[model samples]
Target: MIEQLGPPTLFFTLSSANTKWPDLHKLFPKTQSNTVHHNRMQFIENLVNNPHITTLYLHLRFQIFRDEVIVKQLHATDHWYRYEWQHRGSAHIHGFLWLPQAPNIDNLDSSNHESIQSVKNLFDQYITTWNPRTEVDHLNKQYIPAISNPCLSNTGVISRSEPCTDYTELVNVVQCHMKCLEYTCLKKNSTLKCRYKAHWPEQHDSSLTLDHNNNPSYKPARNDSRLNVHNPMMLAIWRANVDCQAICSKKAILQYISKYVSKTEHKSESYIDILKRIVGLINSEDTILLAYHRFMMGIVADRDISTQETCHMLLKLPLISCTRQFVNLNVGKKIFQL
Candidate 1:
């Protein structure tokens, strides 16, 4: 698609499993226990017991996003998306969108100030890292109670009548986008640096700059360096952690997307050692059926199946969705025939 349609306009990731969502909480039986630990355990138990509900909810949310946001809002000409399960059994989506009208960084001239400004304007229209709380406080000049789980709060919902409704929702949802120094983001055996290269210096105005490889990069104006890029409308509706960014370097972004979507299952060193031992045990005298059974057992033993993924498979849900269909074209065969 990149060869035919140029480069995608945006790349996004949507994560699921908001434990504090009112609808998800309602799935559990009414409990008198108000303790945080007890509620958390109960939620986990419910998820294990009812995996279908979790997967179905995720699928439904993705459908809504595809229809409303991608098609209607962004007016994407074409798109591709894939669903993957996290280590903890939750589901998330990785997607790419091709917008005909959006500026393509690959075609932009870095030296042209007008061209750079146009790209920045398009970025500011959808992506933002600024916190809405700063604007709210500037206008209200009062303190609002901090909401840990904004999805459960009534004020988190955007309303036309309430002037601060959108601001409150933006403030609460943006809080979820804050970047933390977790093990996943940190360099192996090192606590000082982030693996994803986050925590960029604060920029007062959005600008386009060339990366180390001389590829055009768009940097959104940000007040808080710890926050991730997000779309305010998406945050208000999805009410979960979301990452939205413009596709800057076509080669680099395509490489990343391909690697991420085709990533294989993570296997531990112990699992590899066990598989090798099982392979070594196969003997020439052993019956074909018995050897096959033993090998199958070894493979099954090494497999990691999460409750949500199992439920998704049993329900016969598709692992991917795309606006266009693809077919293999054998150019080598045509060349030989000619």
Candidate 2:
């Protein structure tokens, strides 16, 4: 990845449950035929086999480009990304985008006060965890809060799973739902609070943190604890769990991304052979020399997509193909035209 794209400037994750990809939610919809979804293995197999998940992943790839142009207005020069069929019945993606113009310690000829300010402005303008203050934003569902994770109340009673009663109170006090969820875990572990120290009463304060790795990471301030870090346009489109963060230390991020890349996968012998050939090609002297030349010349990386037999089966299904139109909200909106 470093050979193709310089260092990454942004790292983000997109999940299937948080996506608007067509036919994803209907893969095992509660119908007469699919009522026996309690079979965990079958359910996961179905999720892994669903082509809509891949379609969503492809759409999200484009959406990232769209976001760079329309929202951030910055050039996303190059990116390296990967996907995973999560065990919890959804598709997960991790993308590392290298924006040459981003102002940070990673970039050369930058990291000055003005450059830091510019980066900070971009962070503030793009990354936020607050409810929509405008009517347009509300109508667009711009400030979608994550479902409050269950927690123990102040009275030593377990928090309710059904209709939330003290939701407002807990949110007002804890600042973040994750913080609330950690209360019992902390007690069980005999710890004072969350190890990350993120559970404290929320503070809307921006910090220029220089860690042990000498990486300057930016954290934008937000007054409200209920909001998750996300862009309005991003949430509006994906509407699922979305995380956008500035890349601090390139080495640190490289290590983090490597973990995902090295994840063990269930594959056929043919798939394994294909991977081995690709690795050989990548390690070849000619390929390495050519890539180095391209890297030196500042050429960018490209994208690739492929499907397996499972995905092909789903794609070829008549019932699945017939329901593609139901996957998009915009398509549903225009249904009155009929």
Candidate 3:
């Protein structure tokens, strides 16, 4: 995972959840435009145009309690998928929650240290939760490397599972699916049931038009019945956000560590801290890198239909993220149509 991004990649987006105030992007823009999400539409538009990125998925997993799926968040994307192991009192944590980590392993970069934060947010919005120790302990303690071991914190008995393979597989699979879906759509007559709920030139979501002939202008991945959304790769992406995958990864590592150490001291700092140092230290004029970051982040913001089932033709990942997030919001708008 580290190699793919070149360094301990930072989820600058994730850091906002830890803030006491609302996310910086949502609150302010010009001054704190450094937020990866600022001008999300511009970023996404650029992502589609980017030549490096191909396919991508932002997976999120939710905590199921009492038969209710407590969405950590819908994460704005349905193509994201997930996997699970028998609850081992630990959970794997991946922004990309593709798989689990190993014991005696210290992957500080991919730390799933949300020690029982909140699950309710998953039901409504994308939020992070943790059953934290005191602020000092939470802020001061170093996050242990995510090697397999015993459950470190008691957020839950479930342990984070180790990642079985690189999550780039998710991108690969999604790209494949999109390709197939696109083919089928061209050859066959199928659409999001042929319609657009997208707002007007001016109209409420319900007021939008429907194309009974499946002749709608654009097809959303979640609505495309031709493409299977429940595949393994997609599940990996969604799990990163909703499930305990990140938790599971840490759990495995904690368990592994327990086997070797009795009174091991939790480090005084964690990978999260290290990322902050780097992100904070970087100059604003690092324009090329920042541009790339914005490009990828826009892709991550991409979301699909609300329906769980989909069969739409597969779409290719933008080698370079150039599609603006705003396009996704207006996917059904006839304004883009001739």
Candidate 4:
């Protein structure tokens, strides 16, 4: 809680299969099933029991924490969020918000032109790199940011007569590598062309600068590698790899969303990947992608051990101050038929 609910003025990431879920073509409709691995395991179990994709994923997680049109459209005062299921089993949402009259980074006064135009009007009203000339802005054209530069992969034991360094001391740093040449190079070689290189040519348009932890964020334009964005309704209900940002401090967005909210289980494989997944020798689409990544990592580790035993029995219970307003705790408006 960033030392008891303080830092975090917007930071976002929400994903759960994109193309705005039509529930696997409306509950497995296109199937001419020849046991195409049991029609892709009944189309991933009817796209995970889709009741309109769990009612638009619980109405976009309760309109991003109780909507008054998204709390006056992101003027949001307080929020903290976590939900991860990934490993291709979708549902990834890491949010943090706390505007509190935005811009007060230790009293920012960068040669005060009204405090740098109030931090460039809070990064032009909460981030944009420019990509939606409105076709009803269909979610900023799925976050444009293209890339074919995966450390320029030709991974057949390096041999490209060397010569490809120029990272220029990691320009705006955010580096991670490994996984060579699937659709072409992101890593695996000694050189570098683009994980985020080729001289930063991808952010589409939205620049205020300073953030590689120096704070004062917002920088979006990039074309040659493609990264222009301006979130069309959070990429139309969190489809694209939406990563809205603003927070520069609060210990760097609390060590970046607490490394995706207590991330662990990098891997586990006891009986040699479970006897190659119980003698079937895997490959039924990699055993339905390893049983949809171990059934959403065992339902997110049993909902984090039942939310830490209901926060240790509500810290040995003893406080109840009910005013007049009862009900509506908003369990995402409770519609769970499936």
Query: How many residue pairs clash (N, CA or C atoms closer than 3 angstroms) in each of the candidate models, in the order given?
Result: 0, 2, 124, 13
lDDT of 1 at 247: 78
lDDT of 1: 0.69
> Candidate 3 on 225-308: residue-level lDDT in tens?
222212232333332212222222333434533653573333333445544544654467767676456444333322222111
Give per-model TM-scores.
0.75, 0.49, 0.18, 0.26
For model 3, what is the alpha-carbon lDDT of residue 239? 26
Ranking by TM-score: 1, 2, 4, 3
What is the per-residue lDDT of model 4 for residues 238-272, given as tens digits with 9 covering 90 to 100?
33355667765566665775775586744544544
Note the residue pairs that clash in candidate 1.
none
Q: Indicate the residue-level lDDT of 24 in model 3.
A: 21
How do the residues 1-338 of candidate 1 rate in per-residue lDDT, one tens digit apiece? 77777788788887774465556655455534432332555766676577788788778778987899888987888998888776535778888888767876667888898988888788788888776565646354333545454555432243433546654554545443345333236564644567656766778888778888988888888876556787776776776777888877778676876887697886633656755665666677868786566555455434476778888889999888787778988876556543
Ranking by lDDT: 1, 2, 4, 3
Q: What is the C-alpha lDDT of each candidate?
A: 0.69, 0.47, 0.26, 0.45
As a whole number from 0 to 100, the lDDT of residue 122 in candidate 1 is 83
| Model 2: residues with Cα > 4 Å off, grouped in runs | 1-5, 18-75, 107-112, 133-197, 261-338
TM-score of 1: 0.75
